[model samples]
Target: MDAIALLELCNYQIVFPQAQTCCGQPPYNSGEASPAKDVAWHTIQVFSDKKLPVIVPSASCAAMIKHHYPTLFDTGSTEHKQAIELSSRTYELIEFLEPILPYNKQSDSSHTHISLHRSCSALREMEVAEPWLSILRKLDGVEVSLPTLEQECCGFGGTFAIKSPEISAAMTADKCEHLLSPNPQSILSGDCGCLLNISGHIKHSGDKRPCTHIARFIAQRFGIQHD
Candidate 1:
């Protein structure tokens, strides 16, 4: 919802197809190729218009579709061709906006300090660290802090946390510790899974800081609220 609002703020025509579903990252990561392909095909069909770009709020989902979709089919197949076409037009939200949005920093006196949690897929797979930081830096009076270990995962590899609870908990604790060291007012991330994991840990630890999605953070900056 925040994503749509942000795009609309930038004067872009937004379409929300009811037929759209998951990007099949969970199953695909779990090595369930058959069901993953089925889900991916459904997603490809829903966003079939090649001219329109698909902007995904979640870097993990964007990476799955942009990088992994074509691997699901044999080369030279019709499905493979379609996957390639779709991949060409797919982009993560910040990546799509950074190049197009005009950033004339406003002289708002309000100061906000926050930490940014770049999901594994965003940093490693999508290679969007610079783009995300560039967008955040353009905001007036916003201080973006990097955790001590910025590149480490938040221990939210979908099923990996469920399969290895102890290891996940340890990693999450370490991430939370670093995130709280700066004592920021809030934490922001591009992926829901990372936000969920980090926020859950923060809540469990009784931390007062809020964990928010990047779209919602930017939307709030524009005085836009999502229900």
Candidate 2:
């Protein structure tokens, strides 16, 4: 709902379906495979017939529904077939917008600075950095930077962090440490769960930094502007 609202505010036509899960990652990553399967199967059904590409604001979910589904279901199951179809159609929101958003040729020369935090899963799984960076650079009012990290996991491994708060907090601390370099962050853009984790850590650490969903930021920056 927020995504669609922001997309409309930024003038990007949002063609989202009514029914979708919470990405099913929370339970699926846990040993709760049965419920996960039910959720995944539901997703496969909802998205299987989409001829238009599946655009997701969340990278981890897209990666899971795309990359992890086939392994979770039997080969002959309807879920397996649908998973294969959806996987082929799924795309990260940033990856989708970076290519599709109209660039401001004159604006590319303008000035602004921000950092990109390649979320671990999105980095390893979807490789959503370069395209997003390219799109940000194309904005006349913006500059983009690639941030360094100690490791991919920001300790919020879905349920893993829940089962052990200490480990998750440690990971979040390390993540914030790596990300809080002395740089001007107009925004720190990331894929999905990582964004939430990092954003939480930033606030928890008493820092007043801003973060954005890459899609929302890009749409705000360079989607069709209306009067």
Show where candidate 2 strays beyond 4 Å.
Answer: 1-13, 105-110, 223-227
Report how far residue 213 has shifted in candidate 2, in Å: 1.4
lDDT of 1 by residue, 32-90 (tens): 99999999899999999878999999999999999999999999999999999999999
Per-candidate Cα lDDT values, in order, are 0.87, 0.70
The candidate that wins on lDDT is 1
Which number leads on TM-score? 1
* Residue range 18-100, candidate 2, lDDT tens digits: 79767677777877788888888887777766666777777788788788888788898876777888889888776766665
| Model 2 poorest 10 in a row by lDDT | 101-110
> What C-alpha lDDT does candidate 2 achieve relative to the native structure?
0.70
In candidate 1, stretches whose alpha carbon ends up further than 4 angstroms from where it belongs are 102-109
Per-model TM against the reference:
0.95, 0.84
